[model samples]
Target: MTMIFGIPIQAFLGQLLVGLINGSFYAMLSLGLAIIFGLLRIINFAHGAQYMLGAFIGYLLLADLGIGYWPALVLVPLIVGLFGMAVERFALSRLYGVDQLYGLLFTFGLALVIEGVFRYYYGVSGQPYAPPPLLSGGTNLGFMFLPNYRGWVVVASLVVCFGTWALIERTRLGSYLRAATENPRLVQAFGVNVPLLLTLTYGLGSGLAGLAGILAAPVYQVSPLMGSDIIIVVFAVVVVGGMGSILGAIVTGYVLGLAEGLTKVFYPEASNIVVFVIMALVLLVRPAGLFGRDG
Candidate 1:
């Protein structure tokens, strides 16, 4: 049997592929977190709930309404994004002038409420969501058979991550967002509608989470506890990547995901804590994170 580093090469490749798929979710979620935190200075604890909501919404659209995955792909995010915007307008907006802890507590409470409601209705059992008919098959790469949907997930996630980075780093509206993050009062004086921008920024972040959830639905079971399960790792990714650095979040997400995968192969027991261990090391060496700007 072929071996690399005392492990079968095939197994290694499989794990790497799995890591990439998981990394895709990490990148998308962390990117959204970075965006919201950068502008709103709010650590959105409800982000995971939003993600679960996206999956549930996508599932409902397909199962009950007879909507297919293709349409749900577009509609789910729009619906959740509007819901997020409403949250900002009706709830989070009120906390802007108060202590940051208030925002954190409110979001945390919101997460519990959303999760509890879903639990009451759906229970904790996982619900299966099938992929679109087009993505039902697998491709035989010479060394490994790759599922078409997994491949699509990797490609889609990359496109979304890069697109988001370009929007935040290269576009004019993104420039306003960056400037507003620095000094909203000054940006407002310059005629930019900072308040509206803030609302949209939170909506955009929430929308990203929704998109991730939709993508994840076919890969994982849609369950009430799904969001809480993944959000902690995502928070670690955010901390390691630096709160406001968009590119850092994207990079750290994939790297940590891969690291976690490799750990599973070589050190199964440590796999769960590997990301946190890396996070702790990163924090000890550079409190601002690998790409964060020094204060």
Candidate 2:
């Protein structure tokens, strides 16, 4: 019966929850984009397809092979990562020395082929992916009733996002990745296999996308088209975050998500456009995003 700013408190909380859930996906996808763009200077249009592949792989593992979610979570990314590595090796690697536009175009064509193939086989309809048994229920959190699956999603995504940030910003492997990003020739001269590092980085980025897809499967419909639908919004998030910074990607995603949720409560009409609007504002003011370093 209580209301906050003339909206039912429950409704407000619910929308906020939805926003956070959407934000989790945005964070993961944009993080991958940042990684690729910062290092390889490629705008990978096929990331959405990679995400779809992740979900499809997870579903196939469960429905056909009788594998469960826990294991699928681990295996799906590895599978998707290998696929990404192969794409980079055979297809994308050739374009590295050329104009960056070529990289974009190549990935865009690859995205189309991937999405078209999946649509041909699976159609555009959504498929349900049930949450694991342990995450199917909800908890009464006094102020809000939270679904276990959603809670798990937020927590798991936070862990992955921060963990990745730490690994890249703090660890020795991260140092190499950064070094490769900054000066590949120098890093190569130092005996770090730069090309292999690039491949691994691409695989790692794509694998993160896959992991996100697996997390999203139970929360959203598992459909071939799901990736395309969300990818645009994520791209906007990346733009607003500025592609140079990893932490910026993570922060932008969660912030925009909460902003969208608040907008839905205050003015439903603006919720969809809020992200783009923020991106425009960021371009006008900072031009490098909240946490981005000037390139």
Candidate 3:
């Protein structure tokens, strides 16, 4: 048997894979949170619920219309993005220019309402969504076995993360977006529709969460509690990464996920709480957050 740092390579690599998988979700979800907060200045408590909604939408599409995961992969996020856009246009837009707490509370209420509706209809049981046939099996990579679906998830998420980062950091539209956030009035005066941009930004963030949701559907149960279960951890990821730091969210998510996975292998007792412990430390050491700029 081979050993890696005194532990079986299989055990180490298995946990590492698990960490990477978890990190994928964390990175995508927290990226959305960071984007919304960074650009819109709204802390969206409904993000998790939106993620749940995305999964549900995909499940429903498959069940009702015989639409497969492939179709839902794109359709669900677009649907959820539109829903988020509607929310921003009609509801969330109203709360802008007020205390941020109001936005927070409003989103919290929105999440509750959405979750309650789903629970009332679907009950609390977990529903499984099958992965596509192409992603059905595992591969032997000499040192370890890797599930095709899980590997796809990690690769897909990395692509998405970097692609999003590029869109925001290296594009003309992104420059306008950052400029709008920094000076909405100036952008508006220059003939840019700042409100429209705000709505689109929220939509994009919600769309990212929705993408995470559908991606997660085959990996986890499609449950109403799904959002609530993982949301707190994601929020912690955002805080550790810095509230409005896009790159920070992506990096911190993957790193903390690896840390959590390794902890499970080495110290099972602390696996669940490891992320929180790190979060606490980061908070104490840098209240502005690891990637946050001090005001």
Worst 10 residues of 3 by lDDT: 90-99
RMSD of 1: 0.9
Q: What digit string (tens of lDDT, one per residue) describes model 3 on residues 71-154?
A: 899999899999999999999899888999999999999999999999999999988999999999999999999999999999
Shift of residue 81 alpha carbon in model 1, Å = 0.8
The sequence of per-residue lDDT tens digits that candidate 1 reaches over residues 9-92 is 889989989888999999999999999988789999999999999999999999899999999999988998999999999999
What are the lDDT scores of the predictions, listed in order? 0.94, 0.90, 0.95
Ten residues in sequence with the least summed lDDT for candidate 1: 1-10
Selected candidate, larger lDDT, 1 vs 2:
1
RMSD to the true structure for each prediction, in A, is 0.9, 1.1, 0.8
Clashes of each: 0, 0, 0
- In model 3, what is the error at residue 190, expressed in angstroms? 1.3
- After superposition, the stretches of candidate 1 with alpha carbons farther than 4 Å from their true spots are none
By lDDT, rank the candidates, best first.
3, 1, 2
Output the lDDT of residue 293, model 1. Answer: 83
